[model samples]
Structures are given as structure tokens and as C-alpha cells.
Target chain A: MLHSFTIHRAAALLRAGEISATELTAAVLDRIYAVDNAVKAYLTLLPEVALAQAAAADAAIAAARAAGTLADLPILTGIPLAIKDVITVAGVRTTCGSKILESYIAPYQAAVVDRLAAAGAVILGKTNTDEFAMGSSTENSAYFTTHNPWNLDRVPGGSSGGSAAAVCADECLAALGSDTGGSVRQPAALCGVVGIKPTYGRVSRYGLVAYASSLDQIGPLAKDVTDAAILLGAVAGYDPRDSTSVDLPVPDYVGVRDQGAGDRGLHGLRIGVPREYFAPGMQAEVEGAVRAAVELMAELGAEVREVSLPHTDLALPVYYIIAPAEASANLARYDGIRYGLSAPADSLWEGYRRTRGQGFGAEVKRRIMLGTYALSAGYYDAYYLKAQQVRTLIKQDFELALQDVDVIACPTSPTTAFRIGEKVDDPLSMYLSDVFTLSLNLAGICGMSMPCGFDAAGLPIGLQLIAGAFAEATILRAAFAYEQATAWHKQKPAPG
Target chain B: MSLTIAEVEHIAELAKLGLTDAEKALYREQLSAILDYAATLQAVDTSAIPPTATGLPLRNVMREDAVRPSMPREDVLANAPDASEGYFRVRAVFESGD
Candidate 1:
């Protein structure tokens, strides 16, 4: 029962003196111990560390209340949060789901980890991800695959699969996931939870192992929109440590959400239904559910209209080129000379070769090789440069569309959670799984994936609400309205 | 364009990854297919557009040239596979093909 509480409800209980942080954390750790063997949501569970943090949070909260300074109590005090393996946690092993850093402990805290720690959030543990956050399925993880909580045989989606499954199964109050392309939203969609990928620069990328620098963002995954909004408020602010972090004020997302909307809906909101997002091969169930959701929005007093993003067809090609190009460069740092796995060799060059050759997984190697070719001499102008130009066009398409509509509505993925290993062999098919959610990252804008409906098999379908840069408030507001009107967000999975 | 095994091997080498013969062959097929799919971009008429290296239009980001607390030596060497005397040991890198 404690594990099922959202961040808001859990915080309320802690403040009301009805529950101690230590007791609440023990309940969550118990849940992880119970279901994580089948779910495999965590790479490592920091139970001793979590319990210590819980005791500290309980003590601090009690001190604040006794001093009659309850208002000074940290918002995240006692809240349990899961960190994806890709994020650095000082003094904790951060593998990035890759053997290259399998036993590597982070030397320093990531910007987000520092912010969360300052807020007194209890760090439950590190969740799994694609090795180096490359593949769309957790199958790419060097260690194991994370099964969807809905069906034990199906994938939870990835490379944030572990975080998504963790939240969906109530193993943690909420989790942090990094999105480069659809890593956050796609997995959340598949697992039937609320996931947000804030505008590219909204959250700092420092200490988030770079997959694709330009596209990477850190955001929250939660059971409901309000909890996501609350979690977002805690860690989102300009950090001078991250040069690319935008120097803009982070809004009180939870505050705006609780402020009454007179109509209990998004009145006067304009939602654009992109025709291109509903491509020919999209599953009929997904299309029907997303269409029905738009209809519900129309009934909720929001204006729905059809729009086209012509370059939508170019997104996959463009993403494949740009992301790998950046990854190839970023990942070059894992030389045997620095940190991580190193193979002894006769020469330093051979050392670099053997270390990388043995350290990386299949998908990681494929991207690196493809990227090396794309950025190589004589091919740069044709492939890499061309993809960049197309990327500009893709960003412009969203910029122009948002001028007419407040948000773009579409399905998060083309299908529900497919069986594990179904698309693992076909890299192209796996790459195409995030067709609907990729362009938002390219445009460097905000987006949220919330449960819209489910298919015949009971697997969840996600409705994606994408907004302009720094428009997380609008995205959260619209998502909250829809979430309250439907019972989907409240649905819990039968944990394995 | 189809990639030959030799070409795959060459690309793998350029990426500092030592691939086996089988890996080269497998990559030759997979990379060819991915590249062929990427060749679809050539059909778009984009001669007039400029490239976007980053999603945001970032200017030259600069800060004061000041020193800050750096990672401690022990922490920096915490995960190194080979380390000694406050430094990382590696095969000699600058022996000019002697």
C-alpha cells in the first residue's frame, strides 16, 4: 500500500506524521525485493544506503515540524526515487548498462543527483537501461532484459525500460530517466505510466553519460501527471556547471496544476493532430485509441484540428545519422587509458582497439561503426551534413505548427508493448519503434506521454502531448486534465 | 551503397574497434542496409537549407577562466583498470613505429 502511493500522497502522509520516511522506504525496498527478480528493473538496489537516507529524511522532517518550521521541510524529504543507470550517483555504481563501466562507481554526483539529494529524496537504486543507451529495447543491456509488468513475456520498452517498469510496478515512488530521442517516453508509454521529456535544455545533461549530446534531456517518470510535475519542479533549474543548460526560470509546475481550471478541462486549448504521425503500417488499435482520445479532448472543450508535418517521414533517417555521429565522438572517451574495462595489449593503439571491441555490445558497435562512416572523410557532407539540414527543417515544422496549435497530439508509439526479442534482431524495426516520439527531441521541445487507452491484449497505449520549448506547464496541464477524466493512470499492473 | 567486408573492417579500425571476421561480414550487411535506408535523404530537395548542428541556436558559451574544485586523485583513479603512483599506466603511445 505504501509503494502504491504517488509522490504527492506519500509526501502528504509524511508531513501529516502518519508515516515515517524509514517505514515508507522499507515498504518500497520490500516491493523491489518481491518483484524485481522477474521484472529485473534494477541493476543494483541500494537498500542499506536508502534506509540510511530514509532515517535522515525522517529526522530532518521531524525537526522542521517540531521547530514549527514545517514550511521549511524539503519537498522531496522521504520520497523514494529511482535513477536510471545512465545517470551518475556519487559513490554508487553507475554502469550505463554497459560492461565497459560494469563496476565503475561515479566519482562525483550529477547535477540532478545533487539537486535531488539537496531536496532530501531517498535514492532507491539504479535502474537498468540499454548498454550506453543505444537500443530501443532493454535487450541491448549487457546484463539482462526488463520484462513489461503487464505481460512477463513482453518488453517494457527502452532504453529507459527499467525506470518505466519500476514506476509501473510500484517499486519506487518515481524514477528519473534520460531521453535522447524516445528513451524516456517510449518506455513509459509501453509500461503505462506518465513520462516527460522536457525541452532539450530544461534539465541539465551534465553527468548523464552522453548518448546524443544535442538531443539528451533528463526528466521524470511517475504514476500520475501531478507527481511528474512535482518531481520536475525539484530538479529543473539552470545549472552553470552545464554550459548548455539554459538560463531560464523553472516554473512551479505543481502549483499551476493545483490552481483550479474553471472547466475541469483544457478549455480554449488547440491540439494539432498530425496526419503524418498516423502512417500506413501503424497498428489499427493504436490509431483508434489515439483518435478516440482526441475526440475526448474535443469534448473537454479543447479545439482539435488536423495538421501535417511533412518531414515526419525524414525523422528516423535524420535521427539515425545525427545521434550516432554524436555518440561515436562522445563514446571515444572510454579508451583503456581512462576509466572502465581495459584489455592489455602490445601497443596503445591495439589497447584502444581491444578495449572498445570487447567492452561494447552489438547495438553500441553498430552505431559507432555507422557514425564513424557517416563522419568520415568524403561522406560527411552527404550523410552527416545532409541529416543536419533535414534536422533544421524538422525543427521548423514544429515551430510553424505550434504557431497555429498550442500542442501536438499523437500516439507515443505505433504499437503496444511487443513480445521481448520480437524486434531485437531487426535493428531497423527497433529504430522505427519510436516513430511518433522522435521529432520532439529533434525540435528540442517539451513532451509528455500518458496512458490514453489499451489494446485488446490489455497492454497500454500512450497519447503524446508535445509543446513548444519551455512549455512543460502546458504539456503537464493538458495531460493532468485528461488523466483525471480517465481511470487509465490509476490502473496498476499485476507485478510478476 | 553496399559495404564490402574489407570496408567494414576499415571502418571498424577507424573507430578503434577490433572486429572479428564474422563481425565484419555481419556489419557489412547491416551497415549497408542502414546506409541504404539513410540514402532516402538524398531524394529531399534541400540545397538551400543550412545545417543545424545543435537543436538550439547556441552562441559561444564562455565563463571566467577560474579554477574550481577538481576530482580528487583517488576518486579519479577509482575505476581505472591500471593505475600507479597517482597516474594511469598504459602501453607506450609515442614510439614512432620503431
Candidate 2:
């Protein structure tokens, strides 16, 4: 139960001297030891490092209490959190779930990691991910596929699969995941936890290894909306280290909702129901769960209306084209000459060829090739350029719809978590899985996924909430309201 | 635009990746399928739309040109596959048409 405590609850106990950071961290480490064998959520577990941090947090908390500075204690003090392997943690191995960086230790911490450390959070370790954050399932990881906690046979949706699974299984209190093309939201949905992908520049991308630089945003995966909000607040800010990070102010997100309204949750909040998201071919049970959530929003004193993101159908192709094109360039840094796996050959060209050829996995190669082909001569205008134009239309579609609504509601994924290798071979089919969530990234807006219901198989289905750029407070408030009104977030997976 | 084995191989070479024969065949199949599916973009008339490199509006992100501390040489070379004299060492490329 110590591992299950939310940030706010844990903070109160730690402040009152009822529970120490070491005790909570040990509980989480034990939980990971007990469950990670079946779940396979973590790529690395830093027991020694985590215990040292826990001890540091305890000392800091004690010093603050004794000095009458307890009021200024960091909210995340003593909380155990997981970092996705893609985010560098200085001396920790930042594998990004690829063989190329299997032995790669980052030279510096990410801006978010620095912020979290300043807040006194304990890092559990690196969680597994799709190689370079490219796949819908962790199956694409050169390391290992992270199994769903609900059912070991199924995958936790990815490339943030390990992060979501860790949060859901209580391997750690919460986790950070990069949301590029629904990586965070989809996995959080599958694992039955809350996940938030802040507005594109809301969180700095300083140390997240670039995979589609334009689309990637570091976000939080936690047991509930409040915890996600806490973790989000800890990292959401402008950093001079990242050029693209917004100069806009980061509000007190955890306290944002508490000021506005009374018990009539989401009153005067207009929730847009994007009709295209509930289009044909989607799973019946998934649509049913989302529809039920919409109806519940209506009952909770929200004005709900059907809206449209006309470019919804084009999101998949747009994402595939644009993401790969960017990834193609982003991943080019891994040559035998630099940090990471290097295969020496007779010449420089051969070294580049062999190192990349041997280091990258099949899906990574497929994407790289697809990206190269798209950006190649005689095809750049046809594929990559057109996808960019359509991307504008997609952003326009969201902007048009959002003008009339505070937040848009949709399903996180078209379906629940699938079997491990179900659609990996059919690349297009797998790409379509993120149809509902990809456009938000394309629009550079805020979105989150929280549990709405369970399928007949008892798999978790996610309800997605979308808001305009830097509107995390609105999304957080609306989500917290719905979360408070429902028992769905209370559901936990059976022991794996 | 179905990609042939030659096309796949060409792309692989351009990307500095050496694909095995079987991988080239598989990529020819998969990449072609993906490319063919991606051709749907041609149906949309995007003449009026400007391409978006990122969802962020175009702006020259400038910072004060101030010198700052950098990573230590040891830390910089920590993960290098081949390092000599505190620098990344690579194979010679004597006029191999980069």
C-alpha cells in the first residue's frame, strides 16, 4: 500500500514523519522484484542508486523539518518514479531499447531529470521501450518485449510500454514516457493507468534522444490523475537548454482545478465529441466505453456536442511519412565513429554501413528505409512534402474544432492491448492503432488517457481528453473531474 | 510506387546501412507496401497548404552567444566504440565519395 500512495498522500505522510522515503522506496523495489519477472517492464533496476537517492531524500526532508523549512519541502520528495530509457539520466544507461546504445551511459541528465532531482524524486531505473521510440508495441525493442500486467501473454501498448506497465503494476509509483504518435497515451490505456502528453513544448526535449523531434514530448504515467498532475508539474517548464521549449508560464497544475468550481464537476466545460474518432471499423466495446464516458460527461453538467476533425483519416499516413522522415535524420547520429555500438570495417563507409546494419533492429531498418525513400530525390515532394502539408490541415482541423470546445473526448486507441505479436508483421495495421491519438501530437497540443472501462477480456480501454496548446490545466481539470466521478481509475490488474 | 529490391538496396546504401540479401528482399516487400499505402497523399490537393516542419510557428530560436562549460573529455568519450587520445577515432575515408 505504501507503493500505491499518491504524491499528495505520500507527501503528507513524509512531512508528518509517519513514513520515510527509504521505506517507500524499498516497498517499490520489492514490488518490482516480485512482479517485474512476469511483467518485464524495466530494462534496468538501480537498487543501489535508488536506495542512495532515498537516503538523500530522507536526509533532505529531515533537515527541512528541523530547520522550520518543511513548508518548502518538494512535493515529489521520497516518491519513486521510473524514467523511460530514451531520456538520459547522466550516468545511468539510456538504451532507448536498441542494441546500438545497449551499453550507452549518458554524459548528462535531461532537463526533466534535473528538475525531478531538484524536486527530490527517487529514480527507480530505465524502463523498456520500442527501439528509438518507433513502434506501437515493445515487441520492436531489440532488448525484450514488456508484457501487460493484466495478462502476461499480451503486450502493454508502446513505445512507452514499459513505463505504463511499471506504473500499472506498481513497479514504481509513477513513470515518465515520451509521447510520439501515441506512445504514452496508448500504453497507459492498455495498462489501465493515467498518462499525460503535455503540449509539445510544455516539457523540454533537451535530453530525450530525438525520434521525430517535432512530435516527441516527455509526459507522465501514473496511478491516477492527481499523481500524473504532480509529476507533470515537476517537469513542465521552459528550459534554456532546449531551444523549442516555450517561454510560457507553467501554472501550479496540481492546484489549478481546486480554485475554479464546486462539486458540479465540469460545469460550463464544453467537451467536444469528435465523430470521426468513433468512425466505422473501430472495436465495438472500445467505442461503447468511450461513448459511455461521453454520456457521463454530459451527466456531470458538461455541455457535450459532436464535433469533427475532418483530417482524422489522414493522420496515419501523415504520421508515418513525417515521423519516419524526421526519425531518418534524427537516428543518423549513430555512426561507428561516435558513442554507441561500432563495427569497424575496411573503410569509413563500410564502418557506417556495418555498424548501422548490425546495430539497428528490423522495424528500425524498415522505418529508416521508408524515411530515406520518402525523402529521396524524385519522391520528397510526393511523399514527405505532401505529408507536411496534410499535417497543417490536421492541425487546422483540431484548431477549428477546439474553438467551440474546451476539450475533445475520444478513445486513446482503437482497441485494447493486443497479443504480443498480433499486428507487428502488418505495419499499416499496427500504424492505424494510434489513429485517435496521433493528431494531437501533429497539432502540438495537450492530451491524456485515463481508464474508462474494461473489455470483455477485462483489458483496460482508455478515454482520451484533448485541449489546445499549453492547456494542460484544462485537460487536467476535466480529467480529474471525470476521474473523481467514476470508479474506473480504481481498477487494478490481477497479480502477473 | 512499389520499391524494388534495387530501390531498397539503394535507399539502404544512402542511409549508410548494409542490408543482408534476405533483409533487402523483406524491405523491398515491406517498404514498397508502406510506400504504396502512403501514395494516398497524392489524392489531396495541397497546393495551397504550406509544409509544417514542426507544429510550432517558424521562429529563429536565438540565445545569447555566451560561452559555457561543456562535458568533460572522459565523459564525452565514455560510450565511444573507438576512442584514442580523448577523441572519437574512425576509419580512414580516402576519397570514397562520402
Candidate 3:
């Protein structure tokens, strides 16, 4: 099926004139029509817009072919991908999985969207997310929960749940997702796809609906490491509009991975296995699978060593404090005075209260209250400031450890995908699911998750590879090496 | 530490959220649980550590101040709940008697 083809493979076919963008997009649209009801991955499917973009891509490709310059075209040319709802596409409804912006059309597109368009990529539609990207499970989404494609009863691991599920179910070849506390990597792991959470400031966040500014980053979810690398390169770069966007040349990610390394197999690579990441409560199967993957890497000539990131346990608490505090400040713009849902009241204060209370979901409200309490008068130093100081310790831990090892390898999530509504009521339990993935965000590093193995129940487990800031090429190369040696990435889920 | 119902109400007011009494109670319990878990951070010896507000080494990202075209006012207000004459409408901030 065209939808099953990876971005690189599809691009090669398109360049060879064996297929057209229109055929690829229609196949994906047909797949979405066949399975979206059960998967609930997309909040809005832009069939018309996708077809139009596909037509345009075909024209560009045809022109390039006639001019004998087909080889110079972008790698993402004519590739169809899904976008997480948190990122906007101008003239499309971007709900961010919240009711407040249910019918709201984006006034401007995200920098990633513009870059993808420049690369001749097709945007299938906006996928679901945890409301305001707040929850670990997509159950927190106001509209509907996205099911894990591997097993229908399990969550697709959120807040990028929909994007991950879309990729796994073959609804889209690849997808764009935002990660703030493991939203992208965790979901990608649970759904058995490759996902990258780029280093902070690596990708411009100009049009992403803010959840936690300091931690938020746009990334890619795809069928394999190569596709993830391609998608990441297409969207990554400095943008003047986002002040936090770093001014640096994006590395040739695919080239770095394929430069005689596919067969070299991680020779001379230093892989760190942080002892803390394998702490208690991690599923036995998960720990075994990850350890086996590490052993395999060691066999492949990687210098595997046990590294210590002592402040790892504190990442969850620090993330909760920092993320929500920033979220409260960022979400303040949703007052009734501006766009989004407006609730009727006699006075502006009442209007603000009603609008937010009615618009935000339970998890969103809980975080807002937590954030308000943390940043409130007489408590800022104890909560927010304390978290920041601890954050320094956490960041230093990675810096100190990475000096000895080139990349850190661990389980992407504590376990595989959990059953839906499993941890929904207990917010703390839900928060714990992200423990393994949150530290990278706190340290502002890069991480990618790819399938390591499957459990006895046939669920997928993800092996997370992490690197220091702007060291995406390191993780990509390591992941690519691991991927080339294993057949885990080839497995497909039969979504119920 | 556990939060009182009154404290939760106060926080809701501060956050400009009109929560029902049930929501306030539920949130009070959940928030207390979260805060209690977060209390573990106090055990870390961070007294000598400087706070890091952002992980990146970015500061004062100033750009050239020059005239540039902005988004059209119509597009800007296109999603507004209520707009007239290119301005957003909102509830009155004060009572007439005030």
C-alpha cells in the first residue's frame, strides 16, 4: 500500500516516476476513511487540502524531471504526513484537543508547516492531543481518546497519541508531533514507531499552541529512523520569530547516519545506560528487552557503560512544577476578551472565570490550579524557584554524564502502552508514566525512541537513545545502527 | 501538604477559573497529592545551586527594529468571539455604579 511506504522509499519511487503524489495521498485518505473511526487519530482530516497539495507536488516534480534536476529535489517531496493538533496550519481548525478552539481556524501556520510545504510534503490533517498537551494518556483530550494501534484497549501514549497512532496504523507515512515531557517519544514508543524529540531551540516553535514554553519542542514520528531524520531535517532550523530558536546550521542527519555506518554497526560508539532509568516498577519484560538491546549494541562494538544521572528521580516533580507554571502563564491569553470560547457573564472577571472553567478539561484545570498555586504570592520561592534550582542539578547531571558517554540509552517509557482509563483517575500515576522521558526535556537535550522488542502479549517496547543538545546526529546514528541490526522496526500492528 | 477548600477556591479565583464546588474539592485533593509528591524535591541539596529558568544558553535575543508588514486585521480578528471595527469586544470591567 502507498500509505505503508516510508518517506524515503516513497520519495525514491516518486523521483523514479513510478508513482505520483496524488496516488500516494489518495491511498492514505482511503486508509484514514477505512480505519479512523476505530483509531480516532485525527481530529480533522483535510482530504481536499491534501489532494490540492499533492497536485502541486506532482507539478513541481514533473517540472524538475523535465529539467533533469529531479535529484536536486527535497527528500520529503510528495510525502504525506499527519500533524499534531497543537501545531497550527493556516485556515485549518487547530483544537489542541480542547473545546475552546473547537471551531477556531489558525490565523497563521507553524514554521514546521511552512518548511514541510517548501519540501513538497502533503499534510493529511490535524491529529488529536492531550488537551493543551497536558496529559500522558490521550484520555485527557476533550473530544475523544486515541486508541493504541497495537491493542485497541490500550492508550496510544500521549499527548501526541493521535500522531503516533496515525503512523502505526498506516493512516499516514509519517507525522509531526510536539514533545514536552515525552509527548512525542512516549507515544511513538507505545505505538511502535520511531519518534524524535529534537533539542530545544533546534526547531522553531512559532505557531505551536503553547503548553510549556521552556520544555516544548516539535519533532517527528515515522516508520523508521531514516524517515524521522528526514522529517526532522525538513522542519529544523532557526526562525527569527521564535526568540528561543537557536541560530545554528542543521546537520545533515541522514548523511551522518548513512555515511558508511549502516554496515559499520555502532563500532566505537559510546552508549550510556543510566542505572536510575531501570529502577523499580519498570516492567520486567521492558527492562529485559532494553537490556538485551544494550547487550546487542555492545556486541556490535558499542562501548556500553553504566552511567549515573543521580537527579533522575526528581525530573517528574520538577517537570510538573515548571511545565504547569509556564502553562498557566501561557494559557492566560485564552480569556474571553480574545479568540476561543467565550462564556457569558455580567462582568469581565466573571467572564474570564466562566470561559476558562467551561473551556478547559479537568486535567487542564488541575494543572492550571497547580501552576497558580505554585506561582502565587508567598509560594513562588518554595515551588517554582525550588524546581528551577533542582532543574539546574538535573541539567548538570546530564552534562557530567555525557562527558563520559556519547549517548544515553534507556527504555522510552516505564512500560509498554497501558490500558485506556488505567491511570486517568490518578493523576500522579499518569505522571509517573513519563518519568523515564521527562529528564531530557528538563536538560533540553535530544532523544529518539524506536522499537526495541515486543512483550509476550505482542505489545511493542521502545528503546530511547538520548544525546546532548544539538547532537541529534549522534542519537540518529546510534538508532540507525541499532535499527539496521534488528527487525523490530519492521513489525506492524493489526489495530482492532 | 493538603490544601483547604478555601485555599482551592482562592487559587481558582486567582487563575480566573469558575469551578463548581465539586471540581474545587476534587482539585484540592488532587493538587494536594501532587504537591505532596513534589515535596520530595525539598530533600535535594540545592542551596548552592543557581536556578535555571531555561535550559538553553540564550539571553536578550534582540533583532533589528524595522518596519514590517503585519497580519491583516481581518485575519487577526477572524477567530474572535466578538469583533467590531477590528477590535475585540468583551464584558465590562467595572459596574456603572462604581
Candidate 4:
């Protein structure tokens, strides 16, 4: 019964009294208990808290019924959600998949969490992430790696891998994820779910642990486009607490849920296919799947054309330099003195040294060092400053291209999820996997990934749709339309 | 393009992450490969272009200066590793000359 119900469907059932919020919450918890051991999606589970929230939601629904105030409301009233470990939930452990923060409980809820709670959404638990949201796969998590539900041996992308995998595995109805550099979309692509990375500042970041502060944006992961929309509507808005949050009006996300491909499906919608994105060495299956999606868009009435982002080649390099430089600065606040892990040592400096040395995972420490070097005195101008210049050109490239197109389409990842330990030894190869998706972060644009097709191994392939700044509606409309035309998103991985 | 052990140590120090010899060697190898791959950006030229730090067009957004109610001290220290009497406790910093 739980397997077939999405957030919208479950919410309707709960509102109609066909199923109580307690029953819905129990079903999701049962699914988590049954499958999470093999999938390893959740980092922490608070069943008592979840059930308590479910009870509260049930009472709220009952009171609203008595007052006749439940006529028209949000569609996610009683749905369950999994929060990425990077986002704070008051009283829950927000580890960021790092040992340094492993025991650190959040003192206050993130703005997103507060909004979701206000909308009557129940947070089941916190999901795993790369330590400080640093890696391309969940293997970087200090606690545990999230396996792809499709094939337990393969990685579910990172650093929001657990959020993606949890939704894919039906561990939660919808989950929140953050994208610094394709963390949300790439993981969604790998886990075979719909994930959206709202435009920079489109969603508030207050209470979200800082990681590459300028690039990180929190968004949603869900089983389908409508579910993603419902979740986004609840969390996307301005917050006075978050200085970077945009003050733009929140659109009616669910209002446009059924917007199918219009008469000019592909005809008037200029879709750009950057040659740089389809470079040599890209997996044949990935390229084929994305091209097939473009063709499907054309059949639906959209216009497709080859476009050039001449500076595309510089994106990954610039992203690595700038993201790490920011990370180094942002992560500096985590010393033994403040919170979480602390190691005993002879002196204060030694204690700070030993704590971080023992607390941070290898990949995280490596990145901090690299980022620090890039921003250091003698090398700052050459590395950090130069990277910033290239970041601008990357943005200019997008601005130039968007002038001629409505949205850009590409493969979410260069290839599908790789074996868990395949590139763990080679950081460059791992970073290159994000080549197609990083530019969106640097440009502060919104992008989403939906299951397009499956490779020969039955692994899911994701087609990425990127829109210009604050153009989420256009992207969501197109993705929702594409999803309506296809059944790829309906295919689920067989239980391990 | 490969980074040396000493360079890795220097970077680690700059980053404030204390690394042991074993970790430093490992990072030296890893960072070298990453830096080598990142060097691909050097081929692109941008002599006249200005660096962009953000994507939004709006800047210099300021709010009226006003004080607001703050969180309770207990709530603020609920997760601190070391706290006492509504204050964050930390090791005392010594004067550099001392």
C-alpha cells in the first residue's frame, strides 16, 4: 500500500480520513526498518519524535475539520520527509556525515525545517551526506556510505546521496537536499528520483551548515515532479534570518503540476545542447539517453539547437578552486573548543590539531587543506583570484547562451553511479564526474534531474534541465511535462 | 605539477588542519593529481574580464539598523561542547609575546 502512494496521494488520503497521519507515518517507518539496513539511507531515526509529530498532525486535522477550516490547504500536510544531514533540525543530530559533528545536536531548526513543520510535514530522520558536503559520493561520509538502491554495490551520488537514496528506496516521502556543485541533482540522477536545486538564494539557508557558503542552496528530492513541487512550495521563500535568501514571490508550484507539454512542446522552447557537454570520453549510454530525451522533447513540440558555451572547459577547474577556498574559510569555525568532537592533548593548539585530525574524514581534510592553500597569502592571487575570473566567464557563457534559449539540457552525470570504491583513490576522476553539472552552481541557476532512461545494467539515467536565474517554473513545467510523457520514473529497483 | 610533501604540509598548516606525516604524504599525492587536472584552466585567457563572486545582479542590499530579540542563551548553548552559565567556555588565548 505504501509502495504506490506518493506525497500527493498520501496527503489526500490523510486529509480525507481514509488513512490517519499515524497510519501513514507507521507505513513509512516500517519501510525504513525493513529496507534501510541494506540501503543505509538514514544516519539517524527518531521514531518517537516522528510519531509525536504524526499525532500532532492528526490533532491538527481533527481541529481543522471541527472548525471547517480544511477546505483548501497545502497538499503535504501529513507527509513524511527525510532531511539531509547538512540541514539543522532542532534537537536532532545534524552530523553533516562528519565525525567532528557526529554528536552535535542542532540547537535550532533550519528555516526550511521550520517552514516544513509549519506546513505539517513530519521529518522522519536525518540522512547521510559527505562530510561537510565535500565528496562526489556518500563514501566520504564518516559514518556510513549510502548505497544505490538500484544496485547495492554502486554509489548513490553525493553529498546528498542519502537524501536521494532514501526517496528512491521509499524510506521517506520526500527529502531535503543541498547542492553546492550538483550534490542534489547528481545524486537524484543516480538514485533515480526527481531532485531540484533552486536558484541561488531562492531558498533560505539559515541553520544549514555552511559549506562553500556562496554555492550551497537547499532544495527537495521526491519520487516525482509533483511531489518535488509540493515540497519546494513549502520550503522555498524569503527568510529575514537568511541574508542571501531572495525576496521574490513564491509561485504556485502545485498549481502548475499538471502543465503538460504545450502545443509548442519543443517548437518554441529553445533547448541548447552545448558541444562541450557532449565531449569525447563521455559514456555512450549517457550521451545516447540525453540525446534521446532531446528528441523526445522535439517530438513533444520543442526546438532543439546546438549551442556553444566556449568557456565550458574551465568550469570544473574554477569550481574546484573556488569551492574549496570558500570551504576552507567556512569550515574554520569547527575547532575542538566550540562543539562536537574533541581530543585530549597536552596543549590547546595540540588539542585543536588532534581534534580536527581525528574528527574530519580523509576527503574533507584533503579539501580543507587544498582550499586553504588556494586562498593563502602568496598563492591567493594566482589560484583563488584567477579562479574567480574564470567563474565570471563561466557565468558570462551562460548569460550569452540563455539569450538564445529557454533552458539548457544535458546528462546529469557523465556516467551512471560507479562502483563504491572505483574512484575513491583518484580524486580528479571523481571530481570530473560532476563536469556537466558544476557550472550551474557557479552561475547560481536552478536545475533539476529526472529519470530519463535506464542503462543496460538497469541503472537509472538522469536528464538534467537547467533554467536561467529564478526560472524554476519553466524548468519544473518542462520536467513535469517530460515526466508525464514517460514511465521511466515509475520503475523502481528490486529490493535487495 | 605534482605537489611535494613539504608543500602539502604548508597547505595543511594554512588550512589549520593538523596532519601527521602519513596523512601529509597521502594528501600530497592526492592534491598533486587534482592540481594537475585543475591546471587545464590555465589554457583559457581572461586578461580584461572582471571576476564574478556572485550570480545575482543586485548588490549592496542593506537593512535598517535595529536590534531584535535574540535566542535564549540556553537554547544557543544546547549543542556546545563546552558551556557554562550561558557562556561558551574555551581555553584561554595567551599573548603572542608571552
Tens-place lDDT digits, model 3, residues A1-496: 8888999899999999999999999999999998888999999999999999999999999999999999899988788999999999999999999998888999999999999988899999999999999987799999999999889999999999999999999999999999999999999999999999999999999999999999999999999999999899999999999999999999999997668464667787899999999999999999999999999999878999999999998999999999999999999999966688999888888889899999999999989999999999999999999999999999999999999999999999998999998898899999998999999999999999999999988999999999999999988878877888899999997765
Q: After superposition, how far is residue A301 of candidate 2 from its true place, in Å?
A: 0.8
TM-scores of all candidate predictions against the true structure: 0.99, 0.98, 0.99, 0.97
Q: What is candidate 2's TM-score for chain A?
A: 0.99
Q: Give the alpha-carbon lDDT of every model.
A: 0.91, 0.90, 0.93, 0.87
What TM value does model 1 have?
0.99
Worst 10 residues of 4 chain A by lDDT: A258-267
Off by over 4 Å in 4: A259-267, B95-97
Which candidate leads in DockQ? 3
Candidate 2 overall Cα lDDT vs. reference?
0.90
lDDT per residue as tens, model 2, A1-496? 7877777788899999999999999999999988898999999889999999999999999999999999998899888899999999989888999999988889999999999999999999999999999888899999899999988899899999999999998889899999999999999999999999999888999999999999999999999988999899999989988889998888988886575447837788999999888888988999999999999988988999989888888888889999998989998999967788888688888989999999999989888988988899998989999999999999999899999999999999989999998998888888888888899899999999999999999999999999999889998888877888899978888665
**DockQ for the candidates, in order:** 0.85, 0.82, 0.88, 0.70
DockQ of 3: 0.88
Docking class of 2: high
Q: Write the per-residue lDDT of candidate 4 for residues B33-87, one digit (tens) a residue.
A: 7777777767667688788788777677789899988878887777677788878
Q: Rank order by DockQ, top first? A: 3, 1, 2, 4
Model 3 alpha-carbon miss at residue A70, Å: 0.1
Model 4, span A349-430: residue lDDT tens: 7777888888888888878888988888887877888888899999988999999989899999999999999999888889
**For model 4, which pairs clash?**
A265-A301, A265-A302, A266-A301, A266-A302, A266-A303, A267-A301, A267-A302
lDDT of 1 by residue, A1-496 (tens): 8999999899989999999999999999999989999999999999999999999999999899999987778779989999999999999999999999988989988999999999999999999999988877799999999999999899999999999999999999999998998999999999999999999788888889999999999989999999999889888988888888998998989876675466677788999999999989998999999999999988888999998898999999999999999999999999977799899889899999999999999999999999999999999999999999999999999999999999899999999999998998899999999888888898899998999989999999999999999999988778877877899998888876
Better of 3 and 4 by lDDT: 3
